[model samples]
Each structure stands twice: as structure tokens, then as C-alpha cells.
Target: MPARPPAATRRTAVGAALLGLVAVGGCDLDDLDPRSDPAPGSGEPSEPPADADADLVETVVTALSTALAATSAVPPRDRAALRPLARLHRRHLAELGADEPVEGGVASMTAAQVRSREERLQRRLADWSVQAESGELARVLASMSAAVAQQLALPAPRPRGAGGGS
Candidate 1:
């Protein structure tokens, strides 16, 4: 028989063969192409049922009002600053014909807490806007969401100085 290749050479050949087998074995010729995957809202209803959209809008309005009420104790300047945001939500609620009572009681909240609540409400409004059945309603919700988001970026009012001094 012909002399066998050096041990190192044999080991190298075996490793190469094993690597090739593993690489080829892992590949599937019939694998689905990700590029062909269906796009969201394609061949399906993009808008949610009318009643569901109405309910979601009502819920978002209520939550925003509740949050506004909760921030009542945050300095007067801050509270005044937040009123416009609450008014905007109310306007949207009126436009939607959602007459739900603003639920929940007033609770003191830090500026950070107010910001957090506004952020959450903004996100919820955005989601509801996406699911709204009527284009007009969706536009309103999206506008409200954008307004709330813009307010969130504004700095909270500074507390009045204890002593009136320079």
C-alpha cells in the first residue's frame, strides 16, 4: 500500500472535510426567502372595528385626563403649563364624541412622574390612531399624540425661590 500522508496532513484533511459537511448540511435548498414574507397590513384589514376604535379612544382620553388631574399639586406654574395639554385631549375627546367621564382622583406627582405618564399616554394614542377605522379619527388621534409628545420634551417649570433675592 502507498505510505499514508503525514499525521498532520491527515488531521488537516479530516478537519476540512468535517467543516465542509457541517456548512453544507446546515443549508437548506428549499428554505423560505425572508424577502418574500408578507408585509404587515397587506392583504388584511388595517383598521380595527369601529366600536373597538371608539372604546380605545375613550380609554386614552380618560387616562390622559386622569393623569392631568393627578398632576394638580405639582407647582401652580407647572399645573398651568399642563392645562393646555389637558385641553387638547379634551378637544380630541369631544371630536370623537367620547363622553366618558374623566375617571380617578387627584394625586401629587413629581415632574418626572408627569413626564412618564404623558409619554405612556402619547404611545397609547399613537397605537389607537394606527388602529382607528376612520381616516379623520386617525388623523385626530395622531395629532393629539404628536402634541402630547411635544409637550413631554418641554422643561417643567422651576420652583419659586424661597427667598426673593438675586
Candidate 2:
């Protein structure tokens, strides 16, 4: 009769098996971005993926559009600092094949209001990232979320010579 392995050895084997399963499972990426080039010789399918998830795509697009609008509404003092961030949102929209978002509402907002809007947008994007249906879409959403969070984390740029004595 074969001898049973010790408990510690059995636990180690089970742990290793679970870890291997995780490693393999992580590789299942249907990250096929519709915008990406065709695989090998497959020139092009009749139509692009558009999105495996129409709802998710629309949600992301709308969220970004709203956020972009907020940036536009920021008081002039803050717009220069926020220009790169606005551009980032536009790039994300472009990646999703969305046109530049229409600007509506709020010609200008107080600094505090702009900050609040950005914070809300960051949270919404983060939530949508994990909920996304496609792995590539998930990554894109997460990237946008991270970008927003990073922008928020940064100290607002100081006006030249404004901080010398303060």
C-alpha cells in the first residue's frame, strides 16, 4: 500500500495546485480590442466588436463626457493645470471610438465644485473598471480611473512666486 503524505506536505501540494490554477486562469484574456490590428492573416472581420458590452461602453462614454465637461467648467485659474487631464479623458474617448464630448451646462464653476466633480468621477470610473465585461475594457477603465485618482492625489500647481513667503 502506498504511504499517505504528511499533513504539511499535503497542504503544500494543495497550495501549489491552487497557485498554479490562479496562474493559468489569469491567462484567459479575451482582451481583443476591436481597434487593434487583425490576428495573423485574418485581414478583418466584417464588423468590429463595437463593444461586447454596449451598456458598459455607453456608461463609460457618458461618465467621461461628464467629467470632461467639469474640466471645461473649472474656473480659469484651474484650467491650465487641468488641461492635461482633460486631454487624457478625450484620449480615452477616442480609444472607444467616441467623438469629442459635447459641452453642456456650467460655463464655469468654483474651484471647490470642480474638485468635487473630479473626485466623484474618479470613484465612478473605479467602480466601472471592476464591473466591466471585457478584460481589455476593464483595463482601459481601470487605467482611466487610476489616471483620475493620480491627478487628484497631486498637489495643485502653484502660481509662479505665489508660495515664496507663504
Candidate 3:
């Protein structure tokens, strides 16, 4: 029988054969059909169709209103400071026409907790706005989101008698 090639020679031969196959496979010019390319305008990114959830929007508004109302337990000065935010939520509830009864009672929370809740609500509104089907509703949600974000960026109100002169 003829002596088999050395292991190294066999490996080199097999590697060369595989490399030749890859090079040939990569030269398939027929795969570049222009007709297969995405049509003009079709490939351009577009916003996903809105999936409006009216109930969800209503629920968010209610939760925000309740949370703002719960801030009454905070010091009078602090509560007063939060009044604008509360009013905003009230306006949102009215605009959203959130007449559905909310089941739960408001939970007592500190001023910091209230701020955190507002931040959370703002984030939710922003996300919902992206999914809202109605352009007007989405715009409203976006506006509210910006308002809440702006409020969050502001320095927390100093508690009465906390170092500043009376």
C-alpha cells in the first residue's frame, strides 16, 4: 500500500481544500440582486403604530392625583409647595376624563416619597405617550412628562424654619 501523507501534510491539504471552498462560496455575485434590495421609503425607519391604552392612561392619572393628594400629611409649607404639582395632576385627570372610580385609599408618604412617586409617574407617562394612538393624546402626555421632569429637576423646598431666616 502507498504510505499515507504525513499528518501535517494531510492537515495542510484539508485546510487548503476548505479555504478554496470558502473563497468560491464568497464569490456568489448572483446573490447581489438589486431587485432584492429594500424599496425606496420602505427601508426608512418609521414610528411603530400606536397602541393606545385609554384605561392605562386613566389609571396613571388617578394614581398621580391620589399620590399628590396624599402629600397633605407633609408639613403645611411643604404641602403648599407641592400644590402646583397637585394642580397639574388634577388638570391631567380632568383632561383625561378619568371618571372611573379608583379603588384604593391614598397611602401616607413623606415629601421625598411623594417626589419619587411623581418621578415614577412621569416616566410612565412618557412611555405611554410613545404608545398612544391619538396624536393629540400623545402630545398631551409628552407635555405632562416634560412638566413632571422639570418639576423633578427643581431643588426640593426647604422645610419651614430649617435654617433660612423667618
Candidate 4:
């Protein structure tokens, strides 16, 4: 009969096997390194991601900027309440730390383009407000504004490709 391995050798072999298993499973080791960009001619279909946060920010900024400018005046209390919201928007965008400024375009964008996009949204919101019945106009604006406000208030940008959290 073959001689059994000594207890110490048996333990060492088991330890080595376990170590190898862990190394194989660990995230630190990769089939493809994440640090590298996707290969050219990979022929994988990948759409550029939507800039939902930036879009919402631009919409709110444009709509609020235009509406505030267009009105003869807003009540002092309403204006005061709006101040923090505006600040929040700026702070959130700053936190996003996007190298590019919030140009309306996903790729390169300029301030003028951003402003134009905002203006368009502002007009749409205004028309919707006017057409709404039973104070629905105010409700719609308030709801959209609130949604943007909530998104702005988040502590960090959502991860690059999916889902959200504070």
C-alpha cells in the first residue's frame, strides 16, 4: 500500500489549494483588467449612456431661470425658498465633478447650447402649465421641479451606468 503523506504535508497541500481557489475567485484578479478601455473592433454594441442627471439639472436651471426672469416678480417667500434649491443644484453638479461643464450635449457642449436646451424645456413647461386645468399646471411644474430638486439634493452622482442611491 502507498504510504500516507505526513500530517504536516497534508495540511500544507490543503492550504495551498485553498489559496489558489481564493486567488482565482477574487475581484483583484481579472480575466480582463478593468483599467484598460474596451478593445477596438470588439464589435460589441454599446450605446452612449444618457446624461439623465445633467439633463434634469439643465432643465431645472433653464426653466427656473427663464420663469424667474419672465415674471414681473415672484413673492418674497417663494423667492427665498428657491434660493436654497438653486444652491443645491450648483452644489450637486459641482460634486459630480464632471470634467465637462453641463453642456446640453452628451459629447462636447458649450454654455450657449446648454442655455438653449434649458430655454426649450422652459417653454415646454410654460405651455404645459398654461394648458393644464384645475391648478394642474402649477402641480405639474411643482412636481417636475421637485423631482429635479430631489435628484440635485442627492449626495453623489449615480454610478456610471445604472441605478441610484443617496
Report lDDT per candidate. Answer: 0.61, 0.70, 0.64, 0.39
Q: Which stretches of candidate 4 lie over 4 Å from their true place?
A: 1-105, 134-166
lDDT score for candidate 1 against the true structure? 0.61
User: What digit string (tens of lDDT, one per residue) describes model 2 on residues 48-78?
Assistant: 5465667887888988888788777866667
**What is the alpha-carbon lDDT of model 2 when measured against the actual structure?**
0.70
Q: Against the correct fold, how does model 4 do in TM-score?
A: 0.23
lDDT of 3 by residue, 1-166 (tens): 9998757654455455445543443322233223444556776745543434556666666676676566565656678778778777766666666553342366656788888888888888889868866555666676667666666666676787799667
Q: What would the TM-scores of all predictions be? A: 0.56, 0.63, 0.59, 0.23
Residue 133 of model 3, lDDT score: 63
As for candidate 1, its clashing pairs are: none
Q: Determine the backbone clash count of candidate 4.
A: 0
**Which pairs of residues have clashing backbones in candidate 2?**
none
Clashes of 1: 0
Tell me how many clashing residue pairs each candidate has: 0, 0, 0, 0
Q: Measured by TM-score, how close is model 2 to the native structure? A: 0.63
Segments of candidate 3 deviating more than 4 angstroms: 1-52, 99-104, 164-166
Off by over 4 Å in 2: 1-52, 159-166
Q: Model 3 RMSD to the real structure? A: 22.2
Q: Candidate 2 at 150: error in angstroms?
A: 1.3
